[model samples]
Structures are given as structure tokens and as C-alpha cells.
Target chain A: EFDQIHNYFSLNPLYRASEMRKDTAGLQAAKNNMSTKFVLFSDQKPFLLRSEEPSRKYKFAVFNINQLGTELLERGTVIFLGLETWDPDSNAWFAVDIKEELSDIGPKFFPEGKYATPFPVTMQMEPTQAGIFAEAHSVLCWLDKYKFCSTCGSATKIAEGGYKRVCQNWECSSNKGVQNTCYPRVDPSLIMLVVSPDKKDCLLGRQKRFPPKMYSCLAGFMEPGECLEDTCRREVEEESGIKVGRVDYHSSQPWPFPAVLMLGCIAYARTSALKVDTSELEEARWFSRAEVAQMLAGQHPHGLYVPPGEAIAHQLIKSWVASSFSNL
Target chain B: EFDQIHNYFSLNPLYRASEMRKDTAGLQAAKNNMSTKFVLFSDQKPFLLRSEEPSRKYKFAVFNINQLGTELLERGTVIFLGLETWDPDSNAWFAVDIKEELSDIGPKFFPEGKYATPFPVTMQMEPTQAGIFAEAHSVLCWLDKYKFCSTCGSATKIAEGGYKRVCQNWECSSNKGVQNTCYPRVDPSLIMLVVSPDKKDCLLGRQKRFPPKMYSCLAGFMEPGECLEDTCRREVEEESGIKVGRVDYHSSQPWPFPAVLMLGCIAYARTSALKVDTSELEEARWFSRAEVAQMLAGQHPHGLYVPPGEAIAHQLIKSWVASSFSNL
Candidate 1:
């Protein structure tokens, strides 16, 4: 099942030439290239070029140098995402910006409501576009909120080609070793598809924020003193009364609902009991393997639907079901 | 070899009992118990009950509630770091504080210089003590720095039994779902022992900050939008120009020199070449299995030494050597 869940967000068609980011000459050259592409966001919504026909799939309204000629660029922060390897050999650098400059200029260029789209809608586009959107959205979101230093009240300056922020106060501890204040942040979270001892059923839970009849895997942030395995076990036992034995890493997805790295896993449970923690989850129950397969296929008798392809939860459930069915 | 590398820091001899954290009454009752222990810190250094004789090992200078007398307790913060099950079923809630309230009073109660020891020195103590120290140190370090909210720059308030911080601003986004701003921080890092295709030699690197001839496994922070396996491969290649194939998780250690989860792994490299990134590492080279074994045994012929048993890198090398030797 390697790369079975391909085309998810963050699986971009770009080579993040991170090693070359520090080279000012190389970055400058790539940025000024004619093939260089720019994507704009307004209030977290991406300015995408959509097809006129409703039946056609969505596409990103990616802008080139002529489309966003150097005007009012200072009003917004620009992040150098990476060089697009769409052809796997091209040297075109792609950057993204979330600024009022684009919001004002976008309406004059593309039709209103047709150009700007939220992140969730972008999932309908090609995988490369969605991945680019995730990279831009997450970095822009972090910049918007983290304008001030957490250690001190001093404002920070963007460095390392928008990949890092440094506090202006030279005396602050953030200025010292490793520069903790700098770097883009990613909250690591564990999401597991817990299987029963008999392997015929799996545990699923739903939070209050989840849609009606939609259940997903148990998840929580990886805490300070715990490993990935222990985090999965603890979160499972906390949300539901299942005692997990062995945990196997499945896949990973970059969830940009404010920057999260979703580590998906397949957990083996020793106990099949249910003692739901209502505070953490609204409902938790064991679904038979057959029923889970139905849910994944969107033919559940009860109309219980799982999340779409954009979510790691969907992939986790789908992968497990496919493997189990093949064994049968 | 499941718990072969046991008795390391952050490997506690007790359950965290996190489900009971919100139970204020239970916590209050546990705090006043005679068996409940208090480990105090001064400036991030833990206070231990050192032996008068040089031959005896160090111990944590834990004080009970009856010993503190409840006077001047308000000057510092206290965090409950689970229970110690060393005495079988005896319940003892262990708490730690890093306040100066003990700096003046600690010497009066215990032997001079014996009660206040730095963090690295505490590694000489029992695993349970070291684990407790890690918990307290990580939580206190976070609280010490995160006094103000990064989102709004407003002062925050402690909530959820010192596990979370809430912004005072009502309209702040921290007040919304999930409360991202209010959690203990843990930076995830990957540390891997890369082995050659022939399995006879392994790669090691040394930073400028490291002691002379002390080469450990390569490590780097797990960046956002990347998985643990990818982090290992990327970091290894970036630091030493070694292209890795399969990456296997070995173990994890909570390195709380300000809260970092060091995930140890065993990497299988496709190529055994070294093109060291001089900026990231001072030196990197391939060491034969015989040399690594000598370093682990603290009897290297060239006077080179690996980190002691305290570091995950040492354990990783030791585990690989043992496994490889068995194959012979």
C-alpha cells in the first residue's frame, strides 16, 4: 500500500530546494524567472482561477510575473515555498502571499467569487495545486498570528527567506543557540485506526464538531514525555476504553487547519470494551470490518459517511479495509 | 530486548494517570498525603539528596508536604508528575518546583552543595527520579517562557491543572476550538544510527558544540510537513550526503533541555559516502562496527568516546552492535 494514499495535501510536485534557500543569488535568480509562479491568498482564502463550466474540476488561479507585477507587494508577506518540479526538471521557483494587495487587484482581474476559494474547496483541484495551497496557507497562517515574540514582547523579523523569524532583541534568549523563536511550527498529532483482538471490528469516534453520522479515528497531540506508540495507546484508552497493544505507523499528512502533522497508524487492541470519555468525544463505538468497508465505499446502510480523500482518517480506514479484504 | 535500554530518563516506574488530572479533589487530597514527595529546583537544576561518601550514588532530595510546612508555597508553581510505584501499591503524588524559596532554605535542611545539583548530574540517579525531573523541568521551562500569548501578546492564565494556558483576551482565537495556544511544547527530533549496506560500518557526526572526539548519531528537528522517516532521510543526506533506504524506529527519549522528544531510529543507507555539510556539522565519518563497539565500551583505541548511557545515540549504537554481533 505504499503511496496508495497519494495526491493528498503536502505531497507537492515541487522540490523544496531547502539546501539552496540560504544562497541569496540562487533564490534571487529563481524568483525573477519568467516561469516563476505566484499564488495569492486573501483572509486565508486562496485566489484560484476556476473553470467557467461548473462540470469542470477546480484549478488554482496561479499568477505569473506579468499578472502580479511589482505593486503593493510590501503590504503582504511573501513566502518562498519551493521550486516547482512539475516537469521534474524545471527550475521555476514558486512563492505564495496572503496580502490585501492581491485582494484589491484580484477582483479587477478575475470575476468576483469565481477566483477566491477557501482551502477545503481547493481539495477538488489537482494534487499539486492542493499541496501548494497547503504550503502557502500554513506558512501564511503562522505569520499572521505569530507577529510578536513569545519569550519577549518584541516584534520579530522574517529571515531565511521567510522560513524563519528572529527577534529584534539581541539580548533575548531566542537570539541564542538554535534560535527557538525561529522556524515554522507543526503540531504533531497521532490518529490511529484501532482494530479488535479478533480483527473483525475497529474502534471509531466522533467529536461534536464532526458532521452528522461521520466518525473518524481517535486522535490527540503527542505530549512532551511520550513516544508515538505511547501517544496512540494513551489517546485511544482516554477517548475509548480500548487497551492497545502494538502500534504500527501507516502514513502521514500535513493538515493545515492551522498547521498540524497528522501521523496515521494502525493499532492492535487487546480489549474490546467501550467506556467513552464524553468530554473528549461525543460518541465512540466498535464498527464491524464489513460496516467500515461500507462506510468507506459510501454505501453504508445507515448512511454513515467518513471524511473525503483530503483527510488522513479516510486513507487510514480505506487502507485497512482493503488489506483486510484482500486477506479474506 | 523490549526494555533492554530501561532506566533511562523519562522512563517512569509509574502510570501518568492523566485521566484523573481534572479531578481537583483527588489532586488536593494527594498533595497533602505524607507519602507525597516534592522535588525542588533552583535555576533549572534539580535538588538531590547526595551521599556523604563519594562511593554512594546520588538520590533526589524529595521533601514531603509535612517537611515544607506550607509556608511561602505561593512564590512558585507546582506540577503533579504522576505517582511512584516503586513501593508496590503505595500511592505517592510527586510534584516539582524550581523556586528560590528553596535556595536559602534547602541548605538549612540538607547538606551544603549536595541538595542542589544540575540536570546532567541527576542522570546519575535512578530512572524514576530522572523521569520526574524531566517532567518538572519541561513544564516549568514552558511556563517560565510562555507568560504572554503569542497570538495577541496578552498575559495568559493557567488552566487544566497547569497543563494549559489561556489568553486573557476574550476575542482571542485561543478561546476557540482545540485551544492550540494552551499546551505544553515538545519539539519532535529524529536521531538515527545509519548503517552501511554491508552492515559493517555506521555513520556518525559531531557538531562544533560537542566535546572533542565525541561523535554521536546525526539528529535534526522534524520539520513541519514532513514525516519521521522523511526527516531521518533528509537530515542524514543534508548533514552527511548519505542516501538512506529503509528507516526503522528504535526507541524514543524525552530530552527536556527545554522539552524535546528525541525519536531514535535505525537507518539503512544505500550509499556510504560522506559529503559533510560543514555548516551543520564539524565532522562526519564512517565508523566500523568494531570501532563503535569499542566506543560504547568506553575503551576506544584512539581515545574517541561516544556519549554515555544517558544519550539515545549511545543506546542506538549499542542495540545495533548487539543485533549485528548476534547475526555473526
Candidate 2:
């Protein structure tokens, strides 16, 4: 049986009525519906509500249409997230990116709400809510960065309920056929756990930007004309000088840190030599199974640790420790 | 044992010396080396040399450094492909896109060479040469479209051996940490063969643009915050009104029809009913295993056919037919 891993940003709850995107009137009706909810963002930060309990956790702060005034609604880019439920009368969910100048409006709407970055907030929230936050933040970031059309340096307008951007220049090549250039760009990246030849050890690397003593799976973006397997072998060889033999798919995660799909895999190394690329990594070394277990349990002698459970890297390491490497 | 399918455009022969990309002097020396060869493109079409045999097959028309004048080299965007072999003294390979006005120069360099669209040429070339053409075309297409920075509207300068385009504006956020926006964009798409609940039949769909009677698997560009599984389920439901229950990874292919990595899968359908979305698909229906086999053999009663062997769809269908559904 293939046991799929549902990572932090993977458990989305919305129905994503994709066919309804072209129905502008239906979207507008949903936006004006009394039961509709809106997730607000300011400067790409989500407006989250703090729990009153001792844990002080955060949850998505959603507002009704009335809570957002006409001025705010008009100024912000509202994306139709989808229906909250599959029922025809179910509430619709939308995400709007409020301007930085209107950052105080979030507090006005929800007195206990504050805008915060996705990192700690996503880790703290429920998986379903985190998934929603991921979708909203990724779409908003794409919208912010893609103001001008890549084909023609012309201002583009939001279309298809924020799912697409259309260049105003009618004669632009992007406006011709598939309009693929107008869609939100999602960069596919490979993140893998590299097992040694003996299968007793796994390779991990830490970048200069990583937290002290923290190391995780080696990863890089998927380049053109390369499959997931090619990416795995190439990235492993480039980063740690390890030659990979067999690559198996584990699971995938939608990393909304500016729209990336993390394709996770287990790559068996043909060679164990570690020649770390200093430009890409601070250090790369082989970690034995026992040491990995200790790191996961936060009992490592060197104060070493992996990423949190929310990251696919942690799941990859955990799976490696649990499996015999042959099955995976 | 897991058998890998090496589809056309997947078998790249070059040794991509990624580490040396940053060494400008070294790249220059490799470019000017006597053994270095260059692939030429005009208006996004590859220059091909037709074979003298009856097959009239085409191969990549490569040019040495001397054949390309300084004026033409300066006018075109030169991309270092990689070394022809892993040996230190091996020849280097590069790709350059010539201006439309300079199309006549290709014939001058090689009288037998002709610039043609990648479709027929790619289908007719050797698999290794086709892979090179896929890479060169994808990269050149990216360079052509991404003249302006997505983050900032400023005209960008080529960097990192055509792998990156840096915004000239120092204030642009893309210039800071990581410089992710500067990298070439490769969109991840899902192409899946949907099997029926009983596993006796499979679903196929045809877009209006597809050749008459040619049915292929359902595909869609993955949206933000969606795992491969989620994309499979959503795209299947949206395109054919079939709810996918379990999605299994088959393999992947790099389709350079403007830079897409096709993630191929076999999805088990929970619902067998079909309600085709006309806007997306011209028609969709379930074909029994016998019918699929006939179609693959080009013996379908209605002259129906599947995609060619070079496509991942063909591989997915072939695997399904060869293995018991449980094993796949």
C-alpha cells in the first residue's frame, strides 16, 4: 500500500470550484452573499486571530462581506477561494489582499486579530487553515510580483476571479493562444532524503542561512527538460558529490513560500563521498540511522535537529528511520 | 525491479557542468575552444540537417565557433549547454538564438540546414538529439519571453549562463536573498491516465486542438497549494467529472512546448460517470482495455489513436496494459 504523507500545506479543505471561475456573475454573487467569508492579507501577511487559551495559538481571522467596506473591497484584489462546503447554499470563501495603508482595518474588523508572517503562524494553526493560508498567500504573492506582463511590459488586469492575469495589450503574444504566461507561476522543486550505499546512513546538508545546527534534505528547483529523477540525481551530485542510483517518489508538498511544489523522494546513493559545494551549502555529511533518531528526538549530543513536522524534510527523515529503505 | 521508461527528450547526453557555470572565464574558454559546437535557433525554430538516406530523418545542425561570426554571436543570446562528454578534454556544446533577419545565415553556414519548428523536427530526430533540442528550445523560449523582470518592470540582464536573468534595478526585491525570480521558470503539470472503478476500462479525453480522433490523458497545470495527488483529483473531476480515489506515480517527461514538466500518473476513479466540461474538452469517454489495446496498435475500428511513443501518455497506457491494475 502506498501511504501518502499529507504535509502542512497539503490538507486544503476548499472545494476549488474551478469551472465556476469563468462565471464572473456567480463569483460576484458569492462575494456579496451574507454567508461569504473573507481572509484578509496586508503586505502579504495574513490577519490571524490569537486564541485566548494558555497555548495562545493562532487561527485564520475571517470576516463577512459587510465587515469589509466598499472602499477596501474595491482597492484590494479579491480571489475566490471556493465554496466552504459542497452544498449549493454553502458559504463561499474569498481571500483579499488589503493594502498596507489599510493594515489597521484588520484590527478594526477583529479587535483580537494581528497580521503576521506565514512561518510560525502556519506551524501553529490547524492543517486545514494552514492550507488555506498557503493558497491565499501564494496567489497574493504571484499577483503582486506579476503586475506587468512578462511577454509585453504592459499592466495586466485580474481575470477569471484572480486565477488569471490578462495583458491589456491585445496584440501581445501572450494574449494569443493558451495564455499560459498569464497564469500563476508555480516552481516545482525536488527535496530528497539520500540514503548511503550500505543503507545505514543518510545524507543531509545545511546552508549558511539555516538555523544553527539544523540540517535537512538537499533540494533544488527543477530545471527545463529534466524529470523528477534527473533533478534528484543532478541536485544530489551537485550539492554533496553523491551519485544517486535509484530514486523513488515519497510524497509532495505545496510550499507557498512564493509558490513552489516540493516533490519529495528517497534517492539511494551509489557513492558516499561528500564533496560539499561551498557556494550552495555550509556543510554536508552522512548521518547514521541512530544519530538521525537521536536528532529527531532532540537528544543529539551536538544539539543537532531536523526541521519541524510541518516540513516535508522531517517527514522524509521520519519515514527513512521507520522503513528498511528497501520498501520505500 | 522498477523499470524506467526513457522517453524521447528524456535521454540527455550532455554532462551539465553546473559548478562551472559561475566561472565566467572558464565558460568563455570552453565557448572559444576548438572542439566547441553550437546549436542555432531562429524564431524559436531549431536548425536541422536532413539525412541523405531514404528516411530523410533530421539531426541537430551544429556549428563550430569559427562558423559563427562575431557580429552574429554578439546579436544572439548564447547559452552554454554542457560538455559533450565527461572527459576533461571533451568538446563543449552551446545554443544560440539568431535574429529573424539573420535567418539566411543558417543556410550560409550549412547549405543543407533549414530552420523548422520543433514539433516535426523533434519527432524525426534521434532521441539524444531530440533531448538537446528540447533543452535549447525551452531555454531560448524562456529568454525570449522574460526580457523584463517579473518582480520589477525593468529590463533584466542575462546572468548565470542563460540560466538566470537579473533585474537591473538595484531596489528590486528579486535582486536580494536567493534571487529566485531571476531563474528560468519551469511549470509543473499533471498528465494522468484515469482508470475506472472496476479497472476494466480507462478514461480518455480530447481537446479541440488535438488531432482528429487522437485521445490522450487528462492534464492541467497544478495550482498553488496543491500536491500532485490533489492536482490529479481536482483536474480529473473538473475535466471529466470523475472523482479520483487513489493516484499512483508512473513516471515524468519534460515537454518543451514552452517549458513544462509532465508528471505522469495512474489515477483510480471513484466515479465512472463522465460529464465533459466542453470548454476544456471536446469529448471524454471510457474505453475498455480491449479498445485501448486496439487503439495503441492503430487497429481501432474508428481509426482512433493514442499519442505517439515519445509522449508520456503512451508510456502510461502501455504500462497499464502490461501490468495487473493491483501491481501498478
Candidate 3:
């Protein structure tokens, strides 16, 4: 029932496209048409921009950031307000549940993840909300930890729609793009569901941060100069201590949860032994096909489950249990 | 006979999995001891370290750019070298052939788009040199274009092993990583081999840039909010004016050619007619399985051929011809 409710809630009309497009040329249309008021909140506190104060604006430039309007241009702008949320559930600052919108604001934003589709929901913050939030949050998270150039210890700056920064030291010359900031993006990752040799069970693990009774696939970022199988094999071996052979990809999902391309695969276990690494995992274990079926149905005996509808993990696990690999 | 040469030329081994770790801490054991250096040039171009004196001893950073060396390491001197082809057949630089050796005479010079890889392959550009070249060249080429911040018009520097950059605009919040520098590294793309209903023929298209006597899958990048299928459907319609229905996942490739994740699918064509978008493509036509097989084998009676090996399009076409869609 909860899953059913979840399904209905995700039926966002603003982004209800049957398919996605790579070249979206109409984002400028939405930006101008949808310039509304925004309350940028930090840690649940909202930052209000007062009138008569010539709205302070910031442009986060991503080179060729796919704007889906009028020739599929990629340049755009977003203004952010530093407001905290008075949130009750998390007991944090009052945050606006932008993804869980109950009201419809005018201005057709791109809904589909692909071209020219307006964003599914309005954050009710700024007209250019999600674009601003995602760029600022993901890039800044890296910047905070990377204040000085790791290579030369030179100071760096935030430049271009918060997309890039340059080195001051004349001796230091490094060029990096604002990927999550600039351009349309795809971040390669290795994620998979490991199956038992006998075909009766599958492997599942839980992170410490997961919901009370949820278990999803194990995943890790791909290293440079490596193929997807190499990544899958390496990640599975490290995370679960289970040897996998002949790893075949099932599908992929554009998981923009802070920017990652989740590459899903189904691997056959070379061995049944589970040498768990507790430090890496809060817990790890195997589940039967029947048990997995229940979890997908939300009828688990322990009320255990997989990821939500938006996650490819859920779709992947379901595909495995039903033996339908083309569901992507 | 040429097929054998074609096959041999195609089996490029760019990166070999140097090691595998059973657990996280096992990374220490996997460190420098695990990975192997890919031999870059067939002519053995040695990487050199810098010294003020011409007679001084030199040290070159050559080997697989192992992640173990880079994961916890943030600071290191990186050398950036622009491309200059060597005359492998003539023993000098003038008679340069693109297929010959690309020497890395590393004086440890730095400019941009040059960082230590997860594996350090100084000279070993093999089997997939084209793909490898595409990865390094495209990423660096794009970075070379952006030396300053577009926001407040300031400079930027590289950080995090050239994985990121920062702006010099102190007043700009994103200057401190408050904004995005770019989107993610990989761009999600959908490239489908549209097959007709009876399965007697398949659809293939060629861009102007493709080599003569070749055909490959049609592809485009995924946009901001679009779903995978959503992308496939739209790209199919837009490119060839042939609407597609019931798109299913097949496989994907990490097309390092400028960091694109090529999502491969076999779509059931909803229309037999294809009105070519000459603006987007040079030719669009149908090829029988017999022709495809010949193309893969380069035995096409009409001299029509598929893409070279080491390409996702080549693999996709092969997968379809062999009916490689059953197990899952």
C-alpha cells in the first residue's frame, strides 16, 4: 500500500514524458517563464530576499548544460537564497520538501530527465531551483573538502556559476571542468545484484545510513582506465568478499542523487562463501529468491525491502527475481 | 586476410586489471604491488622527469595509474603534454603517422588536463588507443577551453588530482565550492539499433564524420530530467523520424570517447519508413541481417560495413546478429 501511494505521488505532470532526450533546447523558455520567488534554506532556515534590494543573482555555468528550449542551448542562470528550514521531522532547520511538492506553481519547467522536459516539481524557492541546488550542493561539497590544490597546496576559487575555480599561484596551472555544474552529465558507477550459483539465493547488503529495514545493491565508483566488468568484479569482491565471474550488465539508471550513473549488472557467484567485511558494511547476508520476491512486493516477513521506485536497485532486484533483464 | 588484421588490430588491451582486493583494508596489499602499467607506445617512448641541468638524472612517471596510489593521495606533481605524433616508421617527428607512436618526453611540465591516473600508463596505448585517446583528448580539450571563470570573470585552479577546479571570485559563493564547476564526467546516451517487426531487417544510420564503408548505431546524450526509455523514444523519432515503441535495455559501454556512457538497446520499430534528418545525419537506411553479418565480417557484398572493433556500435551490432539476448 505504501508503495502504491508512492507510485501515485510520483506521477508528476510537469515531467511526465514517455521518453527522455539528450538535446533539450527549451530550458531558457522555462527560466524566463518560470522566474518566481524562492526561499533558499540552509540547515532548515530560509533566507528571504527582500524587495528594493536589486535581487542578488548568481549564474552557475556548466559548459553546454543542456537547456531544453529554443535550439537546445546549455547556458542558464540560478539565484540562491541562504535560508534555513524549520523542519519538524528531522528536527533540523525548517526545510522545504521540494521533491515532495503538494502545490503546483506556474511556469513549465523541464520535467523529464532528458531534453526540454521541465523539472517534475517546483521547489517554491527560486524559479531556477533544482539546477541551482544540485550544482551548488554537489560541487561545493567537493570544494569544502578540497580548499587547496592537493597537488600544489595553492589556494583555489569558485568561478563561473560556481562551476569552476582557478589557481592563483603562477606556478600552478590545473584545468578541471564544473561537470555537475556545467554541461549535461553522466557519472559512471558499478552497481549490481549478486546471485547464488544454485540460483536459489542472492546477496544483499545494508549501509549504516539506510532506512530501518532496507537492503539495496552494493556499488562503487569506477576507476580510470578500467572497464565496467573490472569495476563490478572489483567492487563486489571488496564489498562482500564474494568472488564473481563472467559479470554481465543488466541495465543502467541515471541516478542524479548528487550525480552518479548507476551501472547495474547481474553477476554469478563463483563461490557461495560470504566473507563479510563488517567495517565496510553494517551488515551483509544472502536472501532467497522467494524472500526477494516478497521484498519487491513489500510483503517481506521481516518487513525488509529494497530501494524505492526511483532507484534502479529496486528495478534491478525485481528484474533478477522475475528473470526479466530488459526492464530498463 | 584483412579480417584477421582487422581483428588483431582491434584486440587492443588498454588497461589490464592489475589486482583485486577481497576487502577494503586489503587495498594496502593491492597498492603499488597489484596494478600493471599498460604499455603506451609500440615504439617504447619513455616518460622523463625534469631537471634544471641537461646532464642531471631523470625520473619518469610511467606505469598504470593505480587508484591505490591516488585514492588517499591528494598532492602530487602532474605533467601535461600536448599531442605531437612521432615518425615510428621514419625514426623522427616529420613523417608522423597517426597510428604510430605518441611519445611522452615528460619534463614534468603542467598546463591542464594532465593528472596521474588511477593507473599510470606512460607508454602503453594499445588495442583501444583510439578510445583511450578520445578519453584523454576530449577531457583535456574541453578543459583547455575554460581557463577563467564565466560568473564574475575570475581565474581558477585545479584540485583533487585534476578531478576538480575552483574559481578566484571571492565574492562568489561558488568560489568556495558553493556552486558546481561542471556536471558529472560521463554523459548518458541512448543509441539503438531499430529493427523492423518481422526481424528481417534492421535500421542503421551514419553521421558525416564516420569513415566510409561503415555503419553504426544512432546515439545522443540524455538530458537533465529524462528517463532512459524516454530518451530512446525521443532520439529515435527525432533522428530518423521513425517512432519507436516498447524499448528495452540491452547493454551499455563506457565510451571514454569524451566520457559518454553509451546505452545500447534493440528497439521494436513502430514505423518502417525513415525520413532522414540530413541536418543530423548523412544517410539512414535498413540493412538485412545477412548484410550486417557481412559488415561485421567485412564481407558485405555491397561493400557496406559496420564500425571498427573497440566501438560500442560494433559490439551492439554483433550482439544483435548473434542473437545475444537470451540468458537474462
Candidate 4:
């Protein structure tokens, strides 16, 4: 998955160039700022309902960006997965401040409210700094949520640069000095574009949260003991009612919006049939490669478009339309 | 890192010439009766302490290699992380496992009297069967260690393929999820051999772990709010008590044997005088290019050699000694 790019993790120090040198310096400047840094996170609160016998806890985080948070551009800004959604009825939700160059981001994304945190956060990052920060963000987010030991159900404590958590329940004894049961994890997922035999049309699906008329490649969280290709095929079939036969390899992207490694693949559809599950998705349909190119180029006669480049699904669809491969 | 040698990850879909032919027959043929199928992993788990102490209480899944586990060698064995040690005493510990050839796993890895429960986890895997499993192992180990939510002192619960953990304490209301902290969290570190204008030799130090008289490049862990060059300079000064400047990056590698990305760099020494901290390291010295060449060629009269190929330290030392700029 990290094959093509010189990820901060895989990059060899001896092979750096002039541009990368500047980028590294640029990133350090941001980290050393020591000033207020904007941290976008999910805040899920459980409240008791009078009508219900037991309290029903709603799992959510705020995806809303307000003037106070967005105004931190000059100070700093970072975005990641959160639980709260912007209540359209209220005008509280604001747009993310991605500095100046990414102005198009506000228009294409979050015109109403961003469904999730956008990728490639800013505030002076080196080329690979964002990726590293995202990696850290996912794990940090994970640690923030799981504070108690699951095995014995004891309150946990943090250690080692906020990297570890230990149980406080002395009687439980499930946790030691630096180890506990609740796990830190990365979700390995497969997001694929199902291709037609003639290589003319591609598969895309729309969900209720998607902006009106917006479509994207099929995707699903990988199940345990299942293969990537199988997951791809299964998700395609389940969402669009398509039976994938031969699955081709494409690319991968780390969507740390909530700790997911998006494994992108291309599958061959046995029969082009449309069966959309409204419960899961609003519609599933096949679009021609030309139509996708037009959408990507923003020249679609129907005024349709795909997701932006920050996502692997958008890249997957773009790859098919261009017959090009992305090294991510 | 990947710039020098792009491997399976870079090759994309054409994995080792295995194409996705449109036939289930290929799938069946790919399946093996004995060792044809096996669990694969990417994260290197050094099981230094198996069935011991705080970790001992935790359930570790191991196969007997009888009819169920190793007995299915035609299907192969599920290799995983478990601590192995030469001394049973608490003073020392090490993470151990078999990462060498599958044909060579020994009694050292599967010691006697360590019986584990077999859950009979059955499932069909696909395209790189070992990929996700490795992710699971790494993440699970991390969870076993990270008990508390680092941000807020609360308990956490596992979620999303063991990929995430959520804080249960309603008062704290922290929702962070997956983390990379574990028994072997990969510490992204940078190391360098500081050179001089005279170019007579570069700095190398002997750690407590190194054999007597052995010397290698000075290295240090990368700190937060620092760049690679900053790390190079800080590490050089911290270890040898020498001032280093003019840092240049060279290469990188995945030292996954407990999760460490080693960044190799070359630097200019501002001072020639050496002052060693004997507590952390045995000795600090500069070896001429001639001496290092003999060490690299394994003909050093003193029988001193650099680290192995799996480490970037050896590469850094060798590259500096063998480079045309050695005299500069």
C-alpha cells in the first residue's frame, strides 16, 4: 500500500532531495510553534432518557467546524474523525479553515456540513508530515476513547507519551504497569471499483449522507479472516447486487479519518445489473468511463461529480476513467 | 527506503507474477493441502516474554502443530508473537518469534509446557492472506499493553475488528480509538555518522548491547517537534558530546523487529574532541575509512564488525566508509 510514495515511515534519510529538505524544515517549524493548536476530535456524550427504562447512549462526535476552531488557521489547525454531525436545522456548523489555497475545499466539501473530517490537514506540514500526523491522530483518537480495561472492566490510566493505558482496578489485576486488554488498532479495509467486461462502464454507489447526485466506488470494512478481494466482491454484491468475478489490483490510501487503511482494488463484473439496497445505500448504478472523466473534470453535462482526491474511492474511480495507476 | 528497493507493495497487482485469472480453479489450485496455506504477517513481533508476568494472565493463541495447527502444515502453521528469553529471571526480557524461514522454526519458538487454547478460527483469506492478519497481531499486542485512555484517565473497550477502543466513562467523554502503541511500538528514529572537514574518520559508538571493541554509527530516537536534521545533530551531540552540523539525509528502512523506522543521515562534526557517557555506552571512538572497510569486508584484524543487513546502522556506517567523499 505504501509502495509508490516515499512515506515518512519508509523514506531513507540518505536519499533526500532539496525539496524534501525544505519540507522537513517546514514541518518542524509548525511542530515547534508551541502556540494553540486546533485539534478536531469527536465528543460523544451519553444522556439518560426519561421515557426509556435504561439510558440509550448515542454514539457520535462533532464534525462541525465553527468560527472559533476555524479561526485558528493563523494559530494552527488539524482535522480527524469525530462523532458529532452538524444539525442542519441550526446554523452552528462552520467550514474548516485549510489556510488559503484550499478554498475550493469549502465549496466542493462541507457546502452544508462535512460528513467526516477532511484529509490532508494543514498548518505548515512537510510533504510526509501530514501522513505521519494522521497516523498518530488515529492512534491518539483510539487511546482517547478506550480508557478502561475491557476484561475486568476497570478504570485505566495513561502512560508513555499517551501511548499506553493501564487499569486502575487493583482487584482486577488485568493490567500491569504498561500493558492492558483494550486494544489499539488500525482497520484494514478494501475499497474497489467494479469494472465492466467491455471496460467501458464502472461501478459507483450513493449513500443517504452523500451530497445529492454524488456517487463513489463500493467500499466496506474488512471482516476478520476474509480476503481483501473477497471483501471487495462481497461489498460490491451486497451494495450494488453485482457479482464480481476477477478482481484486479489497484492502489491503497491511509484514510485515518478514523483509523482505516483503504485497500483499493478493481474487480470485473460478471453481469451488469443494478440492485440498490435503500436501507444501506440510496442507489447503485454503473457509469461509463467517459461519464466519470467528465465528472472528474467537472465538465459533466449532467452536472454530476465524484468525491475529491483526498479519498481512495475518488482516486479509484479516477484511475479507471484515466486508465492510469496511482502509487499510494 | 522504498526508493532504493520497491518490493511487493510497489509491484501493485502483478504480485510475483500471480495474475487474477477469471477462474475459481486458480483459487483452488492456489490452496495447498499441507504448507500451501499459512498465516502471514508484516509487523515483526519480538515475543521476548511469553507466558510471563502481567502478560501471562492474558490469553495467547498458539497452535500445537499437531493435527490442528502444525499438522496442517500442508496448510502451514499460524506463526505469531510470544515472548522468548534465555533467562527466566525478571531482570531481563525480550520479545521473541520465528521470522526466519518457516522450514526452520525450532523448539526455541514453541517451547514445551506452554499449552494454549485453539479457537479453531476458520475462514477463507484472499490476495495476500497474511497482510490483515499481521495487522491484527500488531494491533492486538498494542491493545494488550495500552489499558487506559492516555488523553483522559478512563477505561476503554475494543471495537472495529479490534481496530479501535472507545472510552466508557461518560464523565470523561473521550472517543479516541485505534492506537499503534504495543510491546513493540515502532519508534521512528534517526542516526548518523558525523564527519569532519579533515575527512579522516567519522564518529561511531559502542553501546552496552554491542560486543567488546565493536563500534558503529552514533544514532538516536527522533523527538517530537524536531526534523531529521535536528535529530541527527541532537543524537550526535548527546552520545559523543560532539557538536555536529551540515546534516544530509541518506536512506531509510523498516526495522520492524519491534517497530522502528531507522533514518540514516550524514553530518559534519563541529568538534573533534570526544566525550562519552559510559553509563549508556561502553565507548565512543572514530575509526578511519581503512579500518571500517576491513570491518565491512569481515577482515578486520580485531574481528570487529558492524550491525547486520536488516539494520540501517550497518548501511550508514558502510556507506560512509566506502563513499568517495570519505576523505572530504
Winner by lDDT: 2
TM-score for all models, in order of appearance: 0.88, 0.96, 0.56, 0.41
lDDT string, candidate 3, A1-328, tens digits: 0111111111112221212122123322222332322222222122232223243222211211122232221111232212122121111110121121311211123221111111222222232333344333333334343344432445665443223345555555354432322343335678889987776788999988787899988887764334566567667877787887767666555443444556677877887888776766788888988888899899998899887555668867887888943322
- lDDT by residue for model 4 (A1-328), tens: 1123122221112211112122434433433333312233222111111122232211112232332333443332232211122221111111122334433333342344222333322212332434434444555555554555654556676443233455677766455432324344445566888887566788888888789868888787653233355456667766777777776555445555545556577788887878776767887787877788888988889788887665567777876777754312
Residue A281 of model 1: what lDDT? 95
Clashing pairs in 1: A48-A61, A49-A61, B49-B61
Error of 4 at B169 (Å): 8.8
Q: Model 2: runs farther than 4 Å from truth?
A: A1-3, A52-56, A325-328, B1-3, B52-56, B325-328
User: In model 3, where do residues sit more than 4 Å from their true spots?
Assistant: A1-182, A224-227, A248-252, A277-280, A290-303, A321-328, B1-184, B299-302, B322-328
Reference-based lDDT, residue A309, model 4 = 62
lDDT of 2 by residue, A151-172 (tens): 7778889988888999889999
**What is the model-wide C-alpha lDDT for candidate 4?**
0.48
What is the iRMS for every candidate structure? 3.2, 2.3, 9.4, 10.7
For model 4 the local lDDT of residue B148 reads 57
Model 4 ranges off by over 4 Å: A1-328, B1-36, B39-140, B143-185, B326-328
lDDT of 4 by residue, B1-328 (tens): 1124211111112111111122234323333233232222212332211334342232222323232333333333122211122121211111122333442233245443222221111011121222233333444444554445544555666443234455566555354232332122334456787776577887778888776766778776653323455456656765777877576656544332223345567788878888886756788888788888888788999798876543457777777776886364
Give the per-residue Cα lDDT of candidate 1 at A70. 56
Per-prediction DockQ comes to 0.39, 0.62, 0.12, 0.07
Q: Give the Cα error of residue B158 in candidate 3, in Å.
A: 7.0
The order of the candidates by DockQ, greatest first, is 2, 1, 3, 4
RMSD of each: 3.9, 2.2, 14.0, 15.8
DockQ, structure candidate 3: 0.12
lDDT of 1 by residue, B1-328 (tens): 1222342665665556676567777776777788777777676667677655463356667678876656634465666676664232357555555466457655557765454445567667666667766777787777777777777778887665567788889898878876456788777788999998788888988999898989899999876556677678778988888888888877778887777888788999889878999998999998888888888888998889898888888899888888834333
